[model samples]
Target: MVNMSTSQSNTSLSNGTAALYPAAVTQRSGGETWFEVGRSKTYTPTADDIGHVLKFECAPSPSPRRLISVSGIDVPGHLDLDGRISSGGTFTVLSYNILSDAYASSELYSYCPSWALSWTYRRQNLLREIVGYRADIVCLQEVQSDHFEEFFAPELDKHGYQALFKRKTAEDNVALIVVLEAKFGNHGIDNPGKRQLVCVLRSSDGNIWFTSVFNSAPHALLAMGKVDPLHPDLAIDPLGILRPAAKLTHQLPLVSAYSSFARVGVGLGLEQRRKMDPATNEPLFTNCTRDFIGTHDYIFYSADSLTVESLLELLDEDSLRKDTALPSPEWSSDHIALLAEFRCKPRTRR
Candidate 1:
């Protein structure tokens, strides 16, 4: 479902310099499901893995690329990913916005056709896309409570993932109403509320990257004017609401000791752009049954001590905001998923 390219460079760690850090390959007959995120054999590194590290990264599905072949594995043949708490040298984090079922009744649903929008259909499709990524840490936004308690939580649990949910502040009313209404609702709550989910994971070197759904790329652009004159969507005014939102979210005054970094969707291919929520103007994605398009999602890392190796094949590479007609055959959700690879930088030993 995603396309990827690879690049390899030799950078060794000795000591002193600290950086936060963060997949492997398999060779098999064409057309078979070569790699299954939690069920298949990814790799079995030999003695060659003692000190050398190889990173394999990809956004899975039918069209998957090896992405990397380093010092030990995959040079001569294919190998599976280690999938341990750490992968010898790297770890991956993924951010996805899977559209919730409650609000999936809009025009977008009709376009991809009603069947694909059905909970049964989209559920499996979303699950396939999500698990296919095989990320160590996954941050999800807009998940409905029932779906979480029933579907995602239990499903991901089978794969050794521990799920945590951050309930939105506005959903308190919806729950109370749902309780009062009792059996009046078909799917429990007409408005199931949106939440954020994070998958806790460890890296080979024990480095952690707090990559999540907050829009944190505002600071990375460094516009000459207070706002980004070049990029209108990212533009800001001296006292605009976004300026403060950006400052509080990305600056992390209390956590300044940690480094921070994010990538702007500016240069990303057009297809990878996000859908927009007509109400708040956030990208319509991660939940499409809504409307509009924009890249309101972002991944931030503690730049002080982390090193990002690759942010691979973003979906919707050529699709842009002007094309917000969701429920398309190309994407199951209004939003597209973003995958990034990372690891702790090797330090210069004293």
Candidate 2:
């Protein structure tokens, strides 16, 4: 059944006035002829409408007769990396920061249409895309506290997902963690400004750990020993005001799943290079806005315990900027979601 919502576009007509047209009437290339299947906003597809494009159209006014069309279930742009892991103990993890309504301002996302930016519109869009991925675990940031209690928690529960929510004190942004299967342990770590959720799952080999972090600082680099504090380009104190006497580093063998996975030619490895930053090898950009575009979200795993089997191909910048920035009709959030499929590596016997 297709549920048509007029929240994205303002309409003067009554509910039953909108039309649902099966792909048979609409031209797949571009032109949409007005052959109406039903006048009601809800439509159920028949076997005959199998291969055609379905579109819904509504006219706001009778005088000028302006028609606005909403496309129906177009093919997603990402490379389909299905069935890559043929065997034992594989799971997928997704990390995303669904832009909070508080921050989804027209001034900030001026390129985005008002109807697309509305919480009513974007919330449904985000949920549809998120559920479609079918990840074993989902970590979402910038989820408002109210939304966690009212909307996301109840809705996801229907899909057999259990969740953990942590909100920053006095901040509208909250961190959400969800797992489809049983988990060994889960925890939330509160940093200076942002929150991180870590999920630990038990495998026959060892404990497989995954984390969703929204960090703008270079702390991840420090922990991995990838950046030198003394380098000319690398500042001893990036924030400047909080310089320390000694450089900070960690002993954890944490690694970015995207960087650790090597590129290949088939279904799973399809467009790996195009998705990554040429220099950093990370995603080209996770957070894209009108003024700022960069990677602020990451999914890290214990490299020694897990091996990446597949990754969801990142959408290119050109596609993202087609509507000037994110929060566009196609994408619900300013940040794009990142997903990786991992398998636990067998432990060596002593």
Candidate 3:
């Protein structure tokens, strides 16, 4: 565990408005947690007024403890943690690809028939829930244009979040990236390709780059020659396409494979059914598991930062583990959201 201690001098404002600063406490377990001392108010803060002070305390276990103090009033607020210090001198940053939108046909099936309606009514509520997590920066995937134009745009504005989206493609697809004004000043947008959107966030602590990506191809499934004797075309390679956008995110590129259980073989008959192998009754339903070592595979790469280690880790774990269990189809959209966290050091000046 790590810990930090911070201090600031009080200052006055010229507009006759004095700011009330809050001391913040941050912790990390499965996800990051943050606590603040005061509420939000409109006021101009002076150089002397300490808007926020953070203390980090590092403790490995229950016994002995050691503490470290990070100085500089211009530091970014997100890096301030009560314990566990990073040399980069920035706040904790988190990014996730939220698969919130469902297909129209799936919606009609009543699994989540009211998804769009409920999302419309509670869009602000959803944004509030995300903000409550206290993540300094966020990158959202699968944000439909209609959803943003009608709901998320105005709702996020209320919270002082500035958003920049990629230009709409011929497919009408776009990804949204948002940054809080309090911590970082907006630099601009970086368009790597049609499917990837990038932005640079500048703060006193450091300049952080964020990217959002969505792959265009569907996942394919492999079939053995004996299993599909009728049609050779019925068999798919199973190894899906990898997106370049994954490279920009500075983490392993994830390929979301949509599983299918539909059969493409000969139709079942009363007499022939008896001869069929019981195990072959539902070939499409069989779970898939694969392992790769020292080779570049279709779904992932061999690069240290770009390898899909987390996804492979999930597949390696036992299904009984609650954390590794696949989410029920009724609740989730077509694919599961994959996430990874990376720590970056502040760039030095010559």
Candidate 4:
């Protein structure tokens, strides 16, 4: 029998050569496995390599079958093995708002007392449905700290995920945001009142960063509006407040900006009707659409091959349909979720 000890040290077992020894006589323990390399010096086994068969011998049991042969055993060391693919391609990400009952804290809203309990049950069910989507990265808005810890966090852990963000309360309104990472590291941004979480993923393929922002009441625009619009302190447009920092850090912006835009639009429509003559009201109202606020959710995505300008151009072209009617409450949330994707340049070989 060829000594296995010498083979391990050589690291150059000959091609088309099979080494065999008594299974019991092998030095490898039950949990240990063997690695084989071909004779070609140009080729070496790496985590990305795959397609090798592993055979095993089993002793005869007290049954009719003698000297049982293991039917199927495959080597599992390679990163590309077992149907695993390289992570160089573009992947989809989804951001969603888990509608926690607005009545939970008994705020100014006039919802039934039982609405909170019913909403919690529905939220759990909705979370389960969201988990089924199998997204690479998930950003959640409106998650309560205690609810996230006691319920959502545990559920997410079962599917290989991590949560970020601490609970904060202002008045009776609570805003929570969390990101679930699938094979990546989590990072955070220090926005004192507007707590945001950023995650960085560095794989052999490329680097991907995701940032989640959950704006509190009097959101980003309003916050910026509080400052003098013409003040030298604000050279950039109010909407551009977050842009500079994001561009400097090279982080993708995925914002879930929810506001009472729907209510605002209704109010605007009423004001327009009052200004029109009684007989011309119908035609004027039909033609006068409220442009006070647009859709809420916005996703900004990019890669090394893409620039901010190009990304914005694409967003303008494909982000929304001007002709499509807005979905009803049952079919949609008060806000929409924006999605963006871009191909990254391949990494250079060393």
Candidate 5:
């Protein structure tokens, strides 16, 4: 099913009169043939749509000041992976730094199209993408505090997710953590300290710990001599291999999920390799923008107790550069989301 969204809600339109606001679907192939598919905000393609390029147009009844039309090549339906995909004792986690509306200024993202950066359009796109992932746990950074309470929280709750937000006292941006209603039992989350958010899910399999991080160690080293000098506790070792002189320690045996992706023959597959950078064996860039393009987000898990099942396919730099940078018509934020599916390891009899 192809779902589309517009600033104006079409919920109140009558059946026969709904055609007044047509959502046209056309195919670009075969010498540009136009098909009278439907006029609703959603379209379900048939078998005939397999090899054709599909486009959608929604013209509102009263028509706005400008024409609102979107056209794109239609891709095939999702692969049938019920048997191949992991189930039971396994859950997916997604980490995304959805750029805050306050920071999405025209000056900062000049390369992005103006319409695509509008909060109205971006929020809908962001929500659609987030829900589409169907992740059990979601961590969002650069979230506007007000949007979390007014938009994301209420909307995600409808999908059975409970939200926990951490906002800086001096800033409007916040970090949001939402977990799906677990079948095993209720989940517990706590903010032990500032700038760090930790969520623990209690299940029959055991406890799964999930954390979202925006570490700037590398960038901080390049910019200055120290990392987050203002927040001493937040600093991490520039190179994760060595322990910092301060000896920041934790009891949890956590591991970097994607770093394991970098290990040769660990989780790398033909399709996964094609999406990663050859030099680093990691996704090309988590955050891509005009001035800078690099990885700035991560989803870490307790590796000792869990195993990686599969990861969300990453999009390469070329595809993201189509609009010069991110916040494009298709992608809503400057940073692409990171998702990893993990299953619990059987407990050993000690």
Candidate 6:
């Protein structure tokens, strides 16, 4: 069974703005727990991103193919973000962990044919999966450093996104980067004001909110607190974020597999948006679990200024059934892609 994010009652601000938020949730026992990690790259999403979708899209394989830009399982024809973004806009962000090429070393990963794990095949496949979504902001984990600098950075740069990277340590692999489209302006539609720095943005009415788009695509298959003590890494996920102090904000539930963990976080603000369609509140699960299959990835956001809209549910996970674990007959990788849609609060008259 899949675990989707349940809708919560919309919260009202002191000014009577109707805002939406994921119900305040915490990890349950033996549940998804989080720690912190730093970025190889960081960026501030500008107003240019307002009218456009900010996707945290993952490359299908990181070997070949990439292009653009969405809605709840929406296509370019259906996702109308431009009109709304001019005043208040909606955009989708994704968090995906396309398994890396190093999986051949794992005994657990032997179920699949070895050739499939080749970076070239997986890279190209990952690119197809990512660009197919046309998301605005993309956060990916388990990305090898060399691949990110040589392929992802240059390739995505062609797609109009600015890239930042944060390598885990000086080891076999490098850090993951956060990518955002830089085609738009400095401030949200109206504020032509240049940002002093890319951390927070101030709307026309002086409502200051978060500046950076938060994402972590760690390398491990288990949550930080749930690491396997018996493992060589002392149960610690090599590509996982395990330090809270390193986290800018608390975020959603995450699981692991070949490319299991990835996420995006946002600050809260007040808005006057109407109630969201519960039917569209989708799950962010991209990886299958042991007993019950559910989301291993997520996007935790504050409804203070952004309105929740349709989330991306491209295909049925059950339908795309994997034979063994991940990287099986069903899907190329063990994890699925995760996406979220949000409408930035419209400029308010002062």
Q: What is the TM-score of each candidate against the true structure?
A: 0.47, 0.60, 0.31, 0.35, 0.58, 0.46
| Residue-by-residue lDDT tens digits, candidate 4, 228-282 | 3333333433444333432332233432211111112233333333333343111
Give the per-residue lDDT of model 5 (tens digit) for 215-284. Answer: 3333232223344444442443233433442342344444545554454343335545555566654566
Model 1 misplaced stretches (Cα beyond 4 Å): 1-88, 171-291, 316-325
Each prediction's whole-model lDDT (CA): 0.42, 0.55, 0.28, 0.32, 0.54, 0.41
Segments in model 4 whose C-alpha atoms lie over 4 Å from true places = 1-87, 103-117, 169-293, 305-333, 339-343, 348-350
Q: After best superposition, candidate 1 residue 142: deviation in angstroms?
A: 0.7
lDDT of 6 by residue, 1-350 (tens): 01112222332111134222223221122433211111124435443223322223132222222211121223222223454323334566666766656543346566666656656456656666677678877777667788898778877887777877766443323222222222455224324331111011110111122111112223122123232333343234454543332342323233211111112222111010111112223233345533334443445443334444544433334444444456653355666665655554444445
Q: Which ten residues in a row have the lowest lDDT in candidate 6?
A: 196-205
- Please, what are the lDDT tens digits per residue for candidate 3 over residues 1-350? 12222332222212256333233333222333333322333334345435433333221111111111112223332232445322432332333333445432333324333433244323433454445444445455456786776566665667776765553343331323322222322111111111221221111111111111111121111111022222222233233322222321233232221101111123322222232234433111112112211110112111211111111011212331222222222212222222222222222223
Clash count of each predicted structure: 46, 1, 24, 1, 0, 53
In angstroms, what RMSD does candidate 4 have relative to the true structure? 23.4
The true-versus-predicted C-alpha distance at residue 31 of model 4, in Å, is 51
TM-score leader: 2
Candidates ranked by lDDT? 2, 5, 1, 6, 4, 3
lDDT of 3 at 234: 25
Model 3 earns a TM-score of 0.31
Lowest summed lDDT window (length 10), candidate 5: 62-71
lDDT of 3 at 260: 11
Q: Positional deviation of 97 in candidate 5, in angstroms?
A: 0.7
Tens-place lDDT digits, model 1, residues 1-350: 21112222312222246411113222122432122223333655444234443434332233342222112222222222442222223567777666667757745355456766667557756777778888877777668887788788988998878998766442121110000111322221222231112121111111121122222223222211133334333343333444443342323211110111122234332222232233432233332333443444444444433345555453332342223455544455666676656543332223
